[model samples]
Target: MTDKNIIWHKVLDDKKELPEGRVKTVTAAHKGICLTHYKGKFSALDNRCPHQGGPLGEGSIENGLLRCPWHGWDFDPCTGHPPGGYDDGIDTFPIKEENDAIFVGLEPEKPHETTVSDIMVETMINWDVTKVFGMVGHSNLGFADAMRRQEEKGNLNFYGIRHEGAAAFAASAYGKLTGKPAACFSIAGPGATNLYTGLWDAKVDRAPILAITGQVKTQVVGTGNFQEVDLVQGFNTVAEFNQRIQRDSRHAELMSLAIKHAILKRDVSHLTLPDEIQELKASSRAKAKTSKNRITPLTIAPPKEAVDEAVKLIKKAKRPVIIMGHGARNHKKEVVKFAERLNAAVLTTFKGKGLISDDHPLGGGVLGRSGTPIASWFMNECDLLIVFGASFSNHTGITPKKPIIQVDFDPLALSKFHQVEVAVWGEISRTLEIFQEEIKGETSAINPRNEIAARWKIWKEEKTKRLSETSDKGISSIAIFEAMNKVTPENAVMCVDVGNNAYSFGRYFEPKNQDFLMSGYLGSIGFALPAAIGAWAAVGNSRPVIAVAGDGGVCQYLAEITTLVNYNMPVKLIIINNNELGKISKEQRAGEFEVWKTALSNPNFAEFAESCGAWGKRVEHQEDLEQAMKELYDQSKPSVLEIIADVNLI
Candidate 1:
């Protein structure tokens, strides 16, 4: 019988231990089966209920009949028959007891069939979205299985995170770094809503990301079912393209469109998958979509008149300055060439830090609130401002009074706050290339390289003076950053959270060849650790990834340290523990308001890191900071260095 048709698989060790007149759920040949022991005999039946698809094993043996817990549906436990003579009944598998074990007989397994999740995942892969950061739950089991199949086939990589928020932030950072869409997955209700903050970060920063959230079964959607929420309405504002997956909807096409909108609009796109719809059988003729002629080139040149006017302004100005922002990240080479041709100083906004090396002769460092004195001096002295891809936020403080020539791919960003001399709507690289060509013979612009060097010298002297003003109570922010600047690798990827630590980093840490990521517009705390995880995923272990956060920021996602330990990620986390919300206190003082509710009671974070299975160290004095940093960076595993910092020294 085993060779001809029936395949007998051992399911339970012994039928005698199952007790009399009881039902238990077991798996045999990857199928859920309900094994019942009634009247001193063993029987097997499908575990799923006919109504509402509840588990029959969870039901009790009432009046010698199996009862489903969902709606109290009753059926005969031994013969798989209903008690009310209803037409609906479950199929039964042949069972036998021998050799102290129970074996269930089943037909030979058939070849796998494609599911709706398979089609959607295939479409996502076709669009080059292969990184998924999320959690698996009861509602999304089928989708998770589809993802598992793809991961087994080497088609994608899935990371199960500790929290849904971390998943969204990881996907956000991945999108920001690669300029491609990474997916975040979650269940319905709370799991879906937990993704809002990170999705808002992606939306505001113009990074592309895809959010896949699971929903309850379609039948119970409007009946206030468990774990059900109106996801489509919840994500309406944050997502540029939002849709729900339905049994009759085009599954592959919906996924393709989501990816398209994410990439083309550079914004969040969300999809809701009903629990039952995810497991629906796919059509044999369905095919995944690709990027074959579906996307257009984004390299647009500036208008001829605008370019001519910009050239005229460039020729007339004696002192010119170039301001770059996050949007100009990919076009740094062209921007540098333009700056070199004009012999002008190059300043970056806080979000645009590390675009131009601070060591460059023309580099004036970051501008605005968390900026250096060198950048502000150059901006104040310049006669004409040439801005590229900058939003002109108040934090950036780009002077509107200066004669400006602004260029951006989005027309709405040009002169967004106020009017400028020239508003050139074009792609950043193409516009810079045009400027380089148009200013070939114009050598009248002053060379500010010498002045830039002098200004940097003055700022360094001031920083040195501040670093010496240390307190016996705790380490100063300047001292911590000074040690970091000396020990941090040149090629490291740095993620900074929002706080006084971030401010000090922007002011003191001179980036060589590093890439800096931050919350930028959102200014959300607790962003560093999760962003560091995403950065490590993007670059792997080839380069070091560091996260800089204040004590208040690190405490928000403290459990994620265990996640790093679980993956053995080589991330060096530097926490400036001031035991207070230092940035808020400074802001309160600046606004003439009493600093209240800003102080925090904290724990020994280094000890916590060690408890989480990562290398941990604490630094109290300025003299020990460098050595602690060295020890932490030398480790081949995840590590943390917590410095007791002075709250008043920032």
Candidate 2:
């Protein structure tokens, strides 16, 4: 009698398709079996070669024996034994032919065992990493299976993107919006390299993100295997913590440390998973780590002496200003209270455009190159400057000549490039709270809110003047942004790409109680659409998600528009079709060089959007801009509004 556990599965309908004296691979009971037909007899053996784990079934039969294609190793086709009595033989499965069909018998499989990937994924979930954006490939199948199990349990959500760059950008934006680490995954070599740009975006902007890369097997890591690269060396500079996952390593502990470094440092953490190690059986006693006592509170108060020095500076100045950067995003309420208590005008950097509502009494618009003149006017006349979590990038001309009090949680960021009157190293919100409490009886400082209002009035008039300066070349950027301001929801989250579109948005679009996300320090193009996808994933359909990009920027990741359609993300993409790299043209003319290679031939973006199953409209005239924008925003699905803007007017 045969073993009762053996089950027969029919794999081939007709033996004629395989031909005589040939070998082919078939799947039976989820296992690969090599079926060989030799001398009018059929035999089934394990498809995997004993050496290098190559697929033996794909090999050809030569000289009355089966030969592996990978290394030309020969084995007896009928018996499961290698040539020359090497003592290594492949396992054989019973085979039978019934009604011109081939069937192979396989024993019942053992219970599924937990793998290293399963252990690490559980650890990631323990740390509350709920979302992952990535591509699944041959090298990452085992790890992907682990993630699939987590998805089945409702512990994680995975989004498959068109490119690895989009995955990285999506993860970066998710981190920025939620202040939690979302992961980006890719295969080794080119797939991993594609993540560099967006990872740098997250790194420099201080967003927490985890990067998981699939590497070649550990045995072939240094052998120059196909699709293999030294991922640890490649990601060294961009990642705060980079490590390789090994069979002997404590897998769950490694994942725990990676997430902790990402969240605590607000930086990118990376892990390289080799092909074989990903599927290794884990220790039965292994457990996932958590954040029960590992995380510390972030609210450190400023030193008494630094706080006193700041108070003296604020009390002495007649005109004072408060400038916040993206770092102050999470503590805007405390910052507003501090500014209100001192009667100081609040201004923001281009990256921090929406930290304080433009409708606020003390709110002065962005303060530098992409900013309104009103912010520069206030900064020019102010006698004292109180900086909060701002990097004095040249793009944001926070004047170095003024008496400045800089407050930050990171000590290295204090006076990074130049000196200041006082450097208060502490959590930004806590420092602001101390300022609000310590400066109760100050009376010498001039209140700049009235001046702010007056300057805004003048700037609005100038904007109105620019709006009418349109030509037949195309619609003006001023008109486009003015219409956007009229139609965009107050609570929307805006993701702006790098280019003239970003500058124009900063100059014209007035944000009201909105959240702004951008590739701040890295200043990468093609960031908006992918980041908008990430923002939508973070907040769902609760608040509107908007993407602002130029024609050149949109072209970089145009395929992501389809991703938005598939997910029904409800993202409103506004493309300024200027037919040129407008910012580069401005730079060329500014440097006394003629514009070159800046011209672009663009397609009908609205039609392209419609083809991707989304609502799309092209606005060619100023009169139609507002209505088209309104219709796009009112829809519950993804949409695109392409505005033909004059490149020269931008």
Per TM-score, the best of the predicted structures is 1
lDDT of 2 at 105: 86
- lDDT of each structure? 0.90, 0.91
Off by over 4 Å in 1: 1-3, 12-24, 36-43, 58-91, 96-102
Relative to the true structure, candidate 1 reaches a TM of 0.94
Q: Which clashing pairs does model 2 show?
A: none
Listing every candidate in turn, what is its Cα RMSD in Å to the true structure after a full C-alpha superposition? 2.5, 3.1
Return the TM-score for each candidate structure: 0.94, 0.91
Weakest 10 consecutive residues of candidate 1 by summed lDDT:
1-10
Question: What is the Å distance of residue 212 in model 2 from its true position?
Answer: 1.3
- Candidate 2 lDDT over residue span 320-344, tens digit each: 8899998888988898887787788
Give the Å shift of residue 556 in candidate 2. 1.7
Over 4 Å off, model 2: 1-3, 6-29, 32-105
